[model samples]
Target chain A: MNGTARHRILRGCRALALAASMLGAPALACTDAPRGTGDLGLIVERAAGRLQLVETTGLTALGAIDGLGDLSHASLVYSRDARYAFVFGRDGGLTKVDLLCRRIEARVLQAGNSIGGAISQDGRLVAVANYAPGGVKVFSSDTLELLADIPAEYEPGKRAKVVGLEDATDGRFVFSLFEAGEIWVADVREPRAPRITRLRNIGAQPYDALVTPDGRWYIAGLFGEDGLALLDLWEPEKGVRRILDGYGRGQEPLPVYKMPHLEGWAIAGRHAWLPAIGRHEVLVVDADTWQEVARIPVAGQPVFVMARPDGRQVWVNFALPHNDVVQVIDTHTRALVETLHPGKAVLHLEFTPRGEAVWISARDDDKVVVYDTATLAPRATLPADKPSGIFFTSRAGRIGL
Target chain B: MPARHLELRHLVEHDCGSCHGMTLAGGLGPPLTPSALEGKPLEYIEAMILRGRPGSAMPAWDAMLSEDDARWIARYLKAGTRK
Candidate 1:
């Protein structure tokens, strides 16, 4: 609807809300009638190529929508209004889905192979990081219309696979090249005319990268080396700095069955909790200095070391044989306080807006386990069909999700 | 088959299946169904598993799986059977 229509509707809602207040029908207050996007979330049914619309507060799945081709490695980004979700699939399917209506508004197969995607700071543009064509494609978030296409070419005839496409502050999108060992920042203020800034020789096989929640720093996790490369967006000319060098020096890293997700790294009070790739430890880095402060050992190779919204605890889930276990760490003390065995093959974990409860998806068990964070007890378990990623609409307001 | 091979099958169906699709019908990776593998050569299938398609998301299993192991997985995938 246009602005005038939206304004008229808002005026009507306010009048109704005022009338309800005068009648003393407290329950009918518009303020209490689901005003925020915090209630909605999405559960990815990987095998079925469907998305389950979930009511996060009630721990109930409303329903599932299908025809999303190749949802494996699918990631979702909500529009600024949180009314629509942009679902990026592995088969290059970019779908604009309506959350309220439970339907796909538009979809287009833009590439042969896509890893994941990101939305611009303003949420006007959505970009997909492609593996096959080795580039990033920018789309109009509202229409899913193609805007700009930037090929990640490292050599004369070689295009590098783009990964870790994240939206930093300003109108820029930052991403790393897995094969090129470089990080490039694309400024898409004009959409049609994008300015590219490339940082070379950052690190070997920078598997994935993440922008800090404040959108200040971009850190890339290296696969071929021990340490990670960091870049300060404010001072891009300082060059890339290598921190936490030789982290895996003495010991041989066990075979990595699945690449650990770097987006899972959490920034809590004073420190950032990062998963040590191929190791059963959570490396705590001093967020201010970007130095390794401590390492808290855990059950297995940590894939998702997510901090609660309150930043009081860091919840961790592992990879492979240890995926069944979920561990909670007290961020203040930096100690493992609780370990819960939710089910088999726990693929992902998501916390509610206030961090009162957490929802975890166990693929093999085919159920999403919800736990009360304070009580550390099971609150509810929702059955799903081979679920993986659980994304909340609350992520819409966050800077780097 | 040995117990180790059984474990390998579990890994393929669950671990690799994380992206390849639990039923092996394909997701991020191509479908490994019997009909999909009908015309593909046995050697090509095995090599694909062992070396992987480097430019794509598929990682080489050379560090983790042996040639014999890749051969077994290739045959099993060609058969398109899942537990």
Candidate 2:
């Protein structure tokens, strides 16, 4: 009970507190590490509501933007300079996002009943597929101004619907008619006024189209035809050639019943990965010859096919047959290398320019799942109020505002 | 009781088990047999049918089925065992 004894006890207690604080330091640091390194941004599309911006890495809810109603699809196209991202939606709503601020600077309503759209390679223009009117609307990327509304030609007695639109490397916009069994080619040299030069009959109900990086030709998945149609974009006058028929396995040639709806297609390098919506396998075709090179067995109905910029791996998203994973195929081996089980109903997938990360929009979970490109592990999940339409800007270093 | 059992059995064969499984053995979903339901109650099955398991392939049947309909499904699942 002396003064010296009391001082010694106080010193011992101080040292004990310091030791405890040191132990707690590591745990606090661990929390910070997970926040910065987890995931970047998630844009959630709520059905008949606004788009919610979420910071996945920090687990911070950024807030929402009103007026983007019932977004059925969305694609984020970053400028080549990586300065900004043009967020294109299915409802014909275009928003110019300042990637750094993650804020919508400009909003433009291009047309009505738009289902999907794509930005030009130069990032100067965006072409949208109008579903109800059966046409495409071209707009200026920088100003969010309407450029052209090209009318699509349909088959006799068949009402047409434009389901997918993609800008070919050759400065032309290729559009797929959902129920018309045709694809229209339009020249967009003058962004404001597109001149429709050719209308080619591909097959039964073309759903989606993709042009090879080389820009020599384009390929489309025929929903009712259950095959892929290869087009010679080089000669628009001669029209598209039905290079491959019954490209996906179906019951058309069999005595038994088969699910033959070929829904999604993508081209990486010289190979085209087609997700057979009716079957449990992905059909790989040689982009040059349009020949069925290989059929890779997958778990469910593969709905979306995307390839990394390096052309090394092709990712397929399953829609039906009920699988909660994205299957990655090695292009060189033509084999299933890895399966990314991120949650459920992965509808759309887009890869960053560097191929360092992948953004997956899962409809069932209403969240965008971000996976590390190298590890293929779920690094973060961006929760959307009602998620749909995922696109990343091709422009590097800038976040899609 | 026989009529109800037959109706429930018909529903399992046609509507429910077609996608889930043939013998409730789990094709697209987990098996719904008695062994698989071990430690789980009928309320769990009913809730799964109503709300569905989030982040899963199973979809909510709340709009399509009533509470009584879900209870019937759970009862049928409990009674039928693939032995």
Candidate 3:
């Protein structure tokens, strides 16, 4: 708020829209001041398939929405009134964006290598978890249109690749197939006659999933073995439930370099904290006895253990020479309280929709370093470019972001 | 182009573009284009970048790359870095 105090509030909203259009009154055509995209956010410019509209209350960078095609592995969602923003990418595009009109109000491509997306439980659908001709499409979130395709064959013609796309609670969605270790659950509540619910084997190569934040537990994450499958969405006939099974049992795991993102798990109180696919740990389960209550050791392989929205600290991050560090723990002394380094390649890390501050991107130091969740310090750095995923519009009302 | 080959072309554009595809055109690792290594063999793409891909999640960068940084990231991913 400097530059002469934001140029005196944009010169007092252009002098109250030039004295209310010289006294005939017809200003604010839509908005210019008093806006409220609830402190917006976007940031995934992965090598310039752009999008950097931020605002966590002005840790500034409010606009830069390029064509957004193959964003290296982009991922987005928000619009339960967070004023639109769908994104997805990895060349399968699917855009939508309109975060207070910063552009891209609809773009499609739809599939041919994709992975990531979800926004329904009634936000009028927006699925999208594909991987070059694999499955799940369901659109129409205010007109990205294509309402439901659903292919992930998982056997017949062998399709598979659709991992952990969540959105539970009636409008259903759930996901995960990764070359068919199965875990479907569609039911888009008739978003084109949906009703699926598969679930088979549920192991090997699950490679990413998550849905608990009260949208009941979905939890995939099995990169071809050793732990984590858990479905339950309030007992779907008690089917898939492998939880921490043989966690690196005979050891020899470490060699992952970026994959752990079970929807950035890390709850804190009844304990959750996941991330250990190839060690450098952080496990600690028992979020109501899914068991295995402690592993913790972190600094590398754990790409994001998150939880700082008042669950009292967790925040991890690493993969690739410990991707320029950022540890923190202390969910009531689960240990390691503060490591930081925060730059060069750090990648994602959100929290600040009531967690006071956490941002963190850094993608090889292009910038974005906030912090200050109760004095973990460095509060504010902004300057993203190669940034990979930093979402936010307060993740539009939560539930499995 | 040595600044350590521009830091090995930024570790093959963001550490092998984190499982190839910062336009290498594949995710969960597969397309390291040059027409997908066109009939493979630049020492089998530098032995899958210094001994990796054994039953998959392709790791072994021979402990952070070498052998001329995996033969200069297999000739800058078979001469196609800006893909």
Q: What are the per-residue Cα lDDT tens digits for candidate 1 across A5-117?
A: 55664565566657767998442222222344568999999878999988976678777778899887788888888878999887789999866556677999999778788
Decreasing TM-score order of the candidates: 1, 2, 3
Top TM-score prediction, candidate number: 1
lDDT of 2: 0.61
Which residue pairs show collisions in model 3?
Answer: A113-A132, A138-A148, A205-A224, A345-A364
Candidate 1 to truth, TM = 0.85
**Reference-based lDDT, each prediction:** 0.84, 0.61, 0.82
Tens digits of per-residue lDDT for model 3, A1-401: 35785466556556766777899865533236546778888889888789888888868987687888778778898989787789898888888977654667679997878878889877998898987788899988988889779998877888877878889897788888887788999887779889898989887888788888888888888887788888888888779989788888898887886677778587777988888877898888888988987797887788878888888888988888888888998888788988989788887889878888889888877888998888899977988777988888888888877
What interface RMSD do all candidates show, one decimal each? 5.1, 15.5, 6.3
After superposing candidate 1 on the true structure, give the runs of residues whose Cα lies further than 4 Å from its correct spot. A1-36, B1-10, B18-71, B78-83
CA shift of A105, model 3, Å: 24
Clashes of each: 0, 13, 4
After superposition, the stretches of candidate 3 with alpha carbons farther than 4 Å from their true spots are A1-7, A12-31, A36-38, A52-250, A254-267, A270-272, A277-282, A285-302, A308-387, A393-401, B1-15, B19-41, B53-76, B81-83
